[model samples]
Structure formats: C-alpha cells, structure tokens
Target: MKIRKLIRDNNYNEYLMDPIYSRLLENVNNLNERIFQKNKLVNLQAFMEGFTFYTSLNYRSTPIDVLPRIISSEFFFKISNYLSARSYVLNKFIREVYQESSTPIPDWIIKTTPYFRSEMIGFSPPKNIYIHVYGADIVRLRGIPFILEDNLRIPSGISYSYKAFEYLTRFLPELSEGYNVLKPNDLEYLYDILRYVSGSKDPTIVLLSDGNYNSAYFEHRFLSDKLGIILAEPNDILVKDKEVVVKTVDEGEVHVDVIYRRIEDLDYLTPGLVKAYLRGWVTIANAPGTGIADDKATFVWVPYLAERYGMKLESVVQPLTFCLYEKENLEKVIDQPTRYVIKKREGYGGIGLAIVKDDNLNILKEIFKEYENFIAQEVLDFDTVVSVVNDSFYETYADLRFFTYYDKVASAVLSRVGIVGSRVTNNSSGGMVKPLWIIQ
Candidate 1:
C-alpha cells in the first residue's frame, strides 16, 4: 500500500482480535486495579516499581491496548534512510554556520541560548559528527508524517522504546508472533560510535547524569546498566592531566574515553570537562555546541539546508515555521495568534510552548516585546489514534519520536499520546508513551 493511502485509511480494528491486543487489555485492567489499590502504601510501591522515573508524581496507567501504529515497510525505510544520510550534511552545515557566522543563519537562531555560544570555534569533534544521537518529533497530518522538530542535543526516551518493546514481546508474545517487528539495536550502534570516536578497542564508557534528583535519572541508570558502563554524576568525574576521569571506590580514578551525557545544559558541566571535550582530549556522544542546530528557529531552515547540502528529502514533511527575529513574520504571528504555536527557541518538554489564541494576544505581545528568542509555527492538526485511558479507549492526539543514530533508525519508535483533551504530546505535558511497531 502507498504511504499516504495507509496513513489516511489507518484503522486499528484490523488487529482488534489479535491475541496481543486481548492480552494488553487484560494487563491494563490489572494495572488499573494495581494503581487504585485500596492500600496507599501498596499502590505507591507498585507505582514506584512499575514506572520509576518514567512518569511524574501524579502517575497514571498508560493505555497499551490499541494496535501499534503501523507504517508501510517501504515508507519506513525511505524516511529512515533519508534521515540517516542527511545527518552528515546537517553536521557540516551547522559547523559551517558556526564557523563563518553566516548571515543567512541568524545569530538569534544559532545562539538562542548562552550555552550555545561556545568560544571553541576551530575545535572539532573526533569524527566530525556533531549529532551522534537524534530524535525527531514527527506528526502525521493529512496522510503525511511531518517533522515537528529535530532534537539534536541530549534527546531522551530511547530506553523507553526499548523497554516497551521488551515488555510487549515478553508479556504478549502472540501479538509479535507473525509480525517482523524491528528490534532495537541502539546500544550496539551507540557502542560502535563511541568506540569509533575514541580510537580505543576497550574505551572506558560512562553515562553521565546530573544526579539522582533529575527526572530522567532512571533512564540514565537504565542505559548505564544496559550498556554495561559506569553511571557517573558530575561530582564523580573530575579533570586530571587534561583528561576526563571517573573516580571509583574499587578502581580509583579511571580514564574515560567516551561520555553519553544525559545532562542538557552545558553550563552545568564543570569547566574541566568542557575543556577536555573542546580540546579533543575526550569524546562526547553528541559533541558540545550542537545545540545550535537544535534551536527551534533553526528547524525552519532544515529544508533549505537539505537542498543546499545536495541531499533530497521528499518523504519528510515539515510545518510552516517563521523565526520571530523577522518583523514580517512576527507581525503575521501576532495577527493570527490562534493559528500559530509560539515557542521558545531553546525550550524543551513543552516548557515554553503556548498555543496562542485571541485571548492570549496581550500576554504574547508583552512576551514578544521582552524576548526575541521565539519562533512561530503553524499549528499542526495532527491525526488521532485510539488510546486507552482510565479503562476506556478514546482517540487522542499522538506524536512519534523517531530515534536516529548518525543517519539510521536506532531503535523502535516511541509513540507518545496526549490525554483526551490535551494538545501537547509530551510526557511532561500530561502525555503517556506507547510502544510503536512497524507492521510488515
């Protein structure tokens, strides 16, 4: 089937009777009971055991009864291959933009945040791969998957996708029986990239975390255990002799070759650590300063960048976006506030996102006066999918987070669904995650 036809005619009822779907319904029912158990202590314990840091304090059972979102094998391959190949071009483009301080690339777009303006200009990473790991938020609208934004710096939730797939296969084997579901090999790919950049056969790899207090600390721990590497906090690592090292109780100070950093803000990292990365003494999975490419304003120029770099991306869809730095675009956004989504250039997890409406014009006008670091994007009327919530199924807004390594799909896609009335599809924005599977 053609990609557009499949997307337009998407219907989960085709697999409603699948044994896997039945099993998921049963498990979710049980999960509901477990979550609402009469004993508070028991419920809390189950919540902690089941969710960990995957959810916030007000934990809710995620609906997994619906069929996994399906895409044709051909369509999947096309987009995946395109994104993978485009990564190289994007890396070079970003480097050139930063190097020359090009006029076409606005300073507000590249230097959206203080952390993004790095003084290390001549320095390059070990492999020249600025974005080692990327997660692109894609939304299907009018039978097309549109790239909402590119997460080039410190993207999370790959572990969630892997775990979801693991749980599905282990708990509902029948659902996966005949389907050629893609297995997540992100760890192997990540390890390969780390080793390639390290120039060491047995490089000491560490997953750096801000601390246990961070929300994603669970994922940090999970990836660390899964990758069989040390999980270190900022205090656990120190700069010595121009090299980043991790202190261990049993092994003393260990030389660290590669760091899969979970922390987002570069400023939070110690000067020594940043210096080591800048000096090329140590390698980071996503090289520092890559945040310049992830700026929301920079996303509006991806298509132009692709064309300039001699890469063709016919499969990728993107919404109409305009940087607020332009007066005409700013005026257009102000005039049609309800038709656009205003966002901070450096915001993540729905922190500074607002669906501007007539009523919010005054507030936005004040914000615009105070901040030029915003972008206006056409609000996407994304397609809806069946999602189970509170023991009932409802069509909810959904988005797919496609994880990429270099330029290839790394793992199973992570599907995030918003609550029934919610528009945002981020877990932090009252959204829940579902496992994504490609039907062969």
Candidate 2:
C-alpha cells in the first residue's frame, strides 16, 4: 500500500496515511521521470515546481481529502457534448444581445445587471469568437451534476491543470492504471484558437494584466512565458490614431495583432484607446462587454437561448429559483427567506451570497431591505463526498469547472474539480483541484 502520512496540528505521532497516498507518490515520480526525459531542464523544473506548489497547497486546504474520482469515457463524451452545446448557446446569445438593444431581455433583470454595457452595439469581434476560454463551476445533487456559474473573464488555473497531470500521475500510479485522464495539450489549443481569431500567422500577442495586484498574476505569467508571448501592463500598451501598438521599455513602437487582456476595467484609458479596440485594431480574447452575458440575470435565460437557437440539448443545471425584485416576487421571497440563497446581481467570488436560515430570517429581511439590490435564489445544498484528512476522514462540498475554447472550427472543453470548505468552490476561496477525465 502506497500511502503518505499527513499529520495535523498538535499531532506529530498521531499521523494518518491512506494506502492510496503511496500509490499517488509512485505515480508522481513516474510522471516526473517522463517529463525529465522529454523536456529541457528548465521546462521540467518549472513544471515540477508548479506541481510541488499545488501538492503542498492541497494539504493546507482545510480538513478535506484528495481522492481521485475516476470518470468513464462514456461520461466524458456526454460532458463534452453538453459543453459544446453550452458554447454554441452562449456564442449565439452574446451575438444576439449585442446586435440589438430592442431585443427583449427581461426589464426587471436588466435593471440589476450593471455590467451590461450598451456601448457594445454593432461592435463585432474580429472573428465570430468570444469567450475563447470558459470555466463554468458545476455541482452535483443526487449524482446529477449542474452548472453553478460561467467564468468568461481571465479564467485562471490552466497552468495548474498542466502541472497537476505531472504531479498526480507520478504520485498515484494505480489511479491511472485503468483510467484515461484527459491530456493537458488543450492549453496550446486555446492559444491556437486565439491566434486563429486574430487571423495572423505570427501575430504579436500580448497578455494584459492589471499589474501584479491581480490574484491570478502567476498563472498569467506562466502562460505567457510558456507560449512565448509578451506580458504587458496597461502602461506598456499604446493606442495611436485608432491602432494598437506596444511601447517596450527599450524598444520604441511595435505593432500588436492580438491583445489577450486580463485587465478588467481601467479608469486611465482615453477615449482613443476604446475606439481602437472597437475598430478591431487588435483582437481581444473575451472581447469587451462580454461580462454582460455572464451576469446571473443572463444565466437564467440560457436554457431558453438554447431552445431559441434550435439546440435540443437540455441544460445540465435545473433552473435556479429566483425572485424578480417585483412587488409580488419580493414579498414571496422575503416571506420564505430560509429556503433561499440571496445574491446581488453584480457579485463575484461569493461576496453577496447569504444562506437564509430559519434563525436568520429577521436579520436577512433587514439585510434585503438595506441592500434592496438583491435576487434570492433557492438554496442548492448539493450532496457531498468523503475525502481523507490525515488518518481521519471528512466530507466537503465540490464543484466542477469546465474550461471551453471556441473557434470557427469547433468548441471543445476541459474540466477541473475543486474541493474544500467553500460552497462556492472557486480556487480563490480555498479549493483543491482535480482533473476531469473524458469518458471513452
């Protein structure tokens, strides 16, 4: 039995080791050996260093276990199909939304979604591509998986995906003995999609970041370095006469073909900068104003959007029960607050989410009154699974985030699962990750 001992605080001799730990260790060693043989020392070292970081971080990720959930190829195929359908639906919806202001999006919903910038009308992307990379959080209830949210903006953790394959495969050999884990080659595929959208053979690509203050700065740097692209700060880019260009520290002016902007909104951009983007001087990965589509209000219409586009695929997620902020709906939601999860329209990373319990109804009602900008969703206490904690065991909530890339040719996806204390299993909120295997 290959098990590594993990001792918790105040317990040195009282350590716990599952037999599976040793198996994982063996697998990691084998993967390291393979990478070491095939790649340059620098590449192998960077990869291994990332693996080590993730491995060490997992232990500190609350009182949860790191067990491998084997997925069948059959299930993989199903998930892939669903993701493809979702991509199609989202792409079509974004186009439709931006193309027409007269398009009847619900009146009550739009009032709450501040991110929906109407300025994006008639502004098509350089290609019919938006959301080239997608990370959708999903959860399971009674063995049925459902989507929680769609991540279109600067979705991080692909670097971790590449590293984890090397780490987990070498660490737990037995787990892979009969399983076919999805390959990590998809990162390059995402890059290729972006390049195609830019329509250039050797497009001068730049990964734009909001300086180092952003949480996913390390991942951005890793991607740019690996892809052999330039990483630029907001100050490093220059838009002149409705054209995009890069101004390096030493080099004067270099033309830019594509801008993979990781920066959200910047206050310093002149009117000329935005005009350059609108003119398609450089291709943007997510394209501006895409944040509008991922709003909770917009998400509610996904199933309808799918149906409208003649897509027969049903949503993996059940319709989330929400109040429309109307007088009738508000009264209903407030009267039975305990059964819901209150969320503000423009919230992120679990900021404005409150689980309304019987004991907190009065407080919750007062909160709703003070912060009148809220939509209450029915509580989705999804089922849990067991993961090991040293020698003892504990159960933690988990969510699967599917990564998708879309080009004119096709839309494909890779998925990752996060497990930890957070009901919202975003990595920023203390979640350990595992790969999503394609069932074949």
Candidate 3:
C-alpha cells in the first residue's frame, strides 16, 4: 500500500520503514522527551505556585509521534469565514428570540443551565455580542469535517495550544521546515475583543479565574502573563460603588474595565460583581447567560437559525442532531440507540456523554430515564491518526478544537485524540493532545 493507505490502515510496520515517517518519528521522540521533562518541572513549579489543578488530572501531558493534522489554507479560510458568519446569525437569533419576555424561546435552551436565570435574560451587553470567544469542536468523519459541538462560554485550551505550538516551533525546527504553518495570535484578538466591548482605547483588562483549584488555572495564569494582564481569582475582585475592582497590595484597589473570565459557573461570582457587569461598569468577555448558545439542545437549531437569519453556511458541515425533548426524536433515538450518541444539554469536560451501541442499548435506556434535557447526534466515525505510546505506534481517533475570537478563527488548533478503543476525545477524559498545522 502507499504511505497514506498504510497510515489509513494503521499498518505500523510499513510506517516504520517509510523514510519521512521514520525521520519525523525520531525527531518527535526527542521532542517528546524534552517536552515531558520540561513540562514535568514546569508543572511541579506551577503546583508550588498555587496552580493546584494543573497536573492533578493527568491531562496536561504532551503526546508523542503524532504528526500535526494538516489542513489546506483554502479549507481553513473557508471554514473560518463560515463559523464567523454563523456566530453573527446565532447571536441575532439569541437576541431576537431570547431578548423579549413575550417571545417564545425554547425552555430547554435557556433553562437547561442554572446560570441562565430570568434576571439575566434580556440582559444585553454593550455590543449585543454574546460569544466573544468560541471553541467549536470539529470531528472528521469519512474524510469530511463536521462541527460536533459549540462551546461559547469560557472556552479553555487556546493558551495551552498556543504554548504547545511555540514549543514545537522552538524545539523542532526541522519538522516545521518547508511547511507554511500559521501561528495563532489569539492574545491580540482576545485583547481586541475586550477593547471593542469595553469601548475603551486602552481598557484596564483582568483575567478572572475561579481559583487555583479550577482545572484550567494554569491556562488562566499563562494567558494573564502572556497577555500582560492581571490574573485575579474570584476573591481578588469586588464591586464597590457599582464598579468592579481588583485588590492588590501595590495598587490598593485597581479599577477593572474589562474582565476575561475563565469560570463557567456564574453563581460563584458575587451578586455585586454581576450587578456591576449588568450596569455596564465592567465588561465580561463572554457575557453571562451565553451558555444558552452552547447548550446541546441549542445546537440542534443552529443551522435553522443561520438559515432563518439569511446567513448562508454552504461550506459548513453540521452533524445531524436531535433534541430529546421532542417526543418523536426521543422515540427515534431510543429505538436505534447504536445510530446515535447522547449528551446532556449543559454537559462539559466530556461528562454526561454516552455512545450508545448494540451492547449498551439496555443500559442507555435506563440512563435515558434520568435525563430530560439531552441531545442525540448521528454516530460519526472519526478519521484515525498515528500516535506512539510506549515506543509502539498505533492509530487513534482524533478531533479538532477550533477556537474563534468574535467570529474570527484563531490561527492555531488544538487536536485531541482518544486512547485505543475509546470514542470521546476530550483531554479531561484521558485524551491526548496533538498540534495542528495548516499547509499553504
């Protein structure tokens, strides 16, 4: 078989003999060791510095011998534009459907999460932009990439992926040679969004973290340092005189005009702080109640919303999704369990997700009894990527996490691959990371 065919078939022996694969594999082995040791020491230092959750879950490691998933520049630009336009349509839908009290918005979309309360409904931000940062998870099935889910609120992993790219380019120059790889400047775009929303030329920006115990605290710290902004935990901030301020030993109380928050649960924030945000004293990157857009049930209506808003998404491929709240959809999913994957409406970190196959029909039925807000999607068999674990080569399922800043795609991508025999490709759920590259 040809090299591509060999890779597709997971023929390890042939891959080992291919000169290009062998050289790349050798370089990756060295790069992996260096990164492993460096990450180990950095993680230890981070833990000491109160990044307690950085290494606690064993999800921070760098995977080995995985070639960067290559995409053409044409496809990259097309998809980015599609997602950007789609975001506008989605935002319009949210504003039109959920902004008015009398409008009939689906209860499952807004009420699925506790954070989307009545008080927050109709609460419009300065620009009516709900999703400033979006992480749209795309999976390739039968050589076509389909958007699996949209994460509108507090999308993590951009900083991590950017750091990983820096490491790759710094340590493995040989691998990046001859390829027109694009580097992501997400920090700039992020700052731009903050500036735009704050309506300030040089806004006082602060990255809010839940605490050191939050799983993505390392990323919070990384972003704060990289973007040259203050990293404040929930306790470090307070609302005084209707303005959000961060307390510091050096400056006493520093006024914060824009806050790029990393926390998902809005309940953890003080009422005063939320009030300050609502009053426009402070701007939040992803405004509160934006979780409705990320809710799994809302994903079923995304294409329809886009079309209704007169936005064409001809280049985009959305997976066939059904909201379980509908009786017909529920029966359809329950009858043919193997044909679909079920997920909770507000699920995150790969939790409350199940892939129903022939063997798990009975179990899924029992599980379904407990879930009122759920979504079922057509089963997509993702393309396999080569990976090396313990010096042995194997093929694993992979998906791409494409980050977008205010409807523009971030230049870099974070690829997550599942372990052998697993379907889910979330880092928190034992998935490994790989760098993605766009070949011009």
Candidate 4:
C-alpha cells in the first residue's frame, strides 16, 4: 500500500521516465538506432495497444515494479541450458508414453510423467533442431533466479514484444545511443521455418483458430498478417480422402502446405485432421500428440532428466520445486498458505490456484478436490520495487517469457515479461507486457 501510494503520486508519465523506465527506453532507442538505422520513427502507441490488448484478458498483471530483480547472465545461462536439457529428455518420455498407452495421456503424476507428450515426445518435428520456440517464466529465490514454468504450447507474446520493441524506440527516442535492436518480424520467420520443416519449400501455410471467439484472436490475426498465411477455422478446413484441405466459397478447394495451428488444445483438432497429420501429408509446427510433456507432473523431473539426456550437463536453469496437493500436504501448509501455492494438475492462468496465506484452507481443499491439482512451490521470493499505477503504487511480480525459433539452424530465444498479480502471466491472461532488452 505504501508503495502504491508513492507510485500514484508520481503518475505514469513520471514512472515511465524513472531509472528503470529510462534504461528500457534507452536500450530500445540505442538498439533501433544501430539496427534499424534505415527505418526512422518506430510506432510506440501501436505497440502499446498490442500489449494492452493481449495482457488485458485473464492476466492480473499490474505495472512492473520500477526495479527489476535482475539475474546474472551466468545464472540465466544455467536456466536456459536446463530448459534445453529438459526438452530433450521430455521428448524421449513423450515417445515412450504414446508407445505404451492407447488412451489419451492421463492426469496421474508419476505414471504419466515418464512419457510427457507435451514435454516433447511422439510426432516428428525437426530432429536436428530441439525446441524451436520456448517461453519460460522465472522468479527469484532469495537472490537467485528460478524457472517457474515453460510455455512450449502455442507460446504467445511475440507479437506483443515485437510491437512494444518498436513502440519504445519511438516514444523515447532520446534513449537510443549505442545498441542495435534487431528487427523482429518473427511471423515471417515462423512461417518460413514451418514450411521448411514440413519438407515443402513452398507450402501453403494455414493459421488455424478455434474461431473469432478464442481469446487470442488478435494474435492469430497478427501472425497471419505478418506471414501472409491463410487463416482458417475447423469448419473452414475439411478432410477428404486422407488429405486435409480448406474449403472456400463457391466450392473452391485449397491445398495446405504446413499448418501453424493456434488452437490451444488437441481436442480442437478435427477428428480427421489428426489422422492427416499422422499420414504426414499436412505438417504441423511442434507437431501433434506432444501435449503431455509440458504437463505439471512431468515438470518435477525436468532437472533429473537433463542429467540423463544432456549427458550430465546440469539443467541450465532450475524450476520451482513442486509437491502434490493431497490432503496430507494441504494440512501441513494450511497455516502458511502464502508461503506456498496450490495449482491444478491441468491449469493455465492460475485457474485453480490457491495462495493460502491470501485465502483460506477450506477453499484450498475444495480447489484441490475439484481440480486434482499440485501444491507448494516454495514461494518464489524476490525483492519488491514500487510501480506507479493510476496515481497508486502496486508491487507486482514480473517474469520473462522468451520465444525461440529453430529452423534449419540451431535454436534461439525471444523474450517478454508478464505484468504482476496475474496467475497466467500471459498477455491473454491480463498481463501488461514490455520488450526484453538483450543487453550486451
């Protein structure tokens, strides 16, 4: 409350020009000056609108505290390596899981964990390339950075970050001085890579959406526009004679090259579509039948897996520790709920999360039963800084989600931060986003 009071008095404008704000502003300007020397005057407002639109959904994010909890590169590198290793091991696990089970992946922790589909198994992606695009959240423990979660499933925020990166350069032109900010029109790269991987040099890429009703419709539009790809819904695409094709008005037909599907879950894939993917006529990014790998239960073993798959190279980063939210664990944690958090086994956006200290145990029990969730990640404690918001100060937790792409080459990373207080930390989950600076 005190911080909120201070932030409010300062006003958003003043906060924007504060040290951290100014640093971010300077970094963007300098990067643009060096990199985009040919293109003058970046669009900050448009970028902000993109950020606003995506983060306003279910994210409970507030303004980022002026002072970021910075992690050293050595530490950051460790985290990155860990993610890489985990991805490899998880890939192995997914293949095994699918091989063993005819049924859909279950919610059970141990049994299902060994073969996490979402983690990275079953289905052909670029074999030489690992995770093409990865978005992992980090929170500080004491002073060390810890990985929160990984978003390999249709990771969002690339459009937001690209827009924001340009916007910051324009809004704070004075900040540009030394650095070269790489221009990130990732959608084109994404389309190209998907096509390359699909083994079609010039395939017709399609952006699949559940419908306009989906929360991230804006992102679907953004990517489609950027890549010059066709946007189609399930109904718009039809399967005939074992091939997936898009049906156009006037009874026209369009063949697909590769599918950049934006639909969140496998259930959304038309029944015949999965068969089409299996036949390998139509290609999908990250491919289908890989959802279970990223499941929460499998997450607990990522560190161990890294050692096994990565040839004893420790995981680059460490994930927050996890525990089951059974009655026994809940009873011990009831008193210090804030010290721990309870999350559903299958959750996105803090949907069934219970911050015990902030709420109550009875409520926690109900959530546990209803969601069959996991419990107690030692609260990711980090230093808090003040953020000025609407003439008020709010302390918010900020974490970065980096998007990486792997084409014919090695893997790379793209990063963004979710605004605080939002469980999901996704732009669609009500997060306020800012561009991540790759400071030299």
Task: Find the candidate with the highest lDDT and give its number.
Answer: 3
lDDT of each: 0.69, 0.59, 0.71, 0.53
Tens-place lDDT digits, model 2, residues 196-220: 9888987888888865556566667
lDDT value for candidate 2?
0.59
Please rank every candidate by lDDT, starting with the best: 3, 1, 2, 4
Give the winner by TM-score.
Answer: 3
**Model 3, runs deviating above 4 Å:** 1-66, 102-108, 111-115, 358-367
Task: Compute the lDDT of residue 215 as modeled in candidate 2.
Answer: 59
Which stretches of model 1 miss by more than 4 angstroms? Answer: 1-50, 54-67, 99-104, 357-363
Tens-digit per-residue lDDT, 1-440, candidate 3: 13344465653332333333454545555564553444444434434544323446443443333355566678788789878987786677667655765333466556555546466666888788878898888876655668998888888877656655665565456666556677776578777888899888988899988776677877888888878889887888988887889987888899999988888665556556777887889988788777767778778888877777788876769988988777788888877888998888878878878888623665466446855677888987766766545434556777788888886788777877787667787767777666677666
Which ten-residue region of model 4 has the weakest summed lDDT?
A: 59-68
Summed backbone clashes in each candidate are 1, 19, 0, 39
C-alpha RMSD between model 2 and the true structure: 7.3
| Model 3 Cα RMSD, 1 decimal | 4.3
All models, RMSD in angstroms: 5.5, 7.3, 4.3, 7.0
Show the lowest summed lDDT stretch of 10 residues, model 2: 9-18
Candidate 4 structure quality by residue, lDDT tens digits, 1-440: 34325444544322332343445444433543342332222323343344334233442222221222223344445665655555556556555555544332234664533224443234444443324455566554344456666656666656655555555555444444444333444455566567676676777878888765665666688778877788888888877876778876754788886777777564455766756766766777665545555566556666665565454535334645565545666655665567776665555655655566555676665654643456456655443333323334455545556454542211223233344453345444445554444433
Residue 319 displacement (Å), model 3 = 1.5
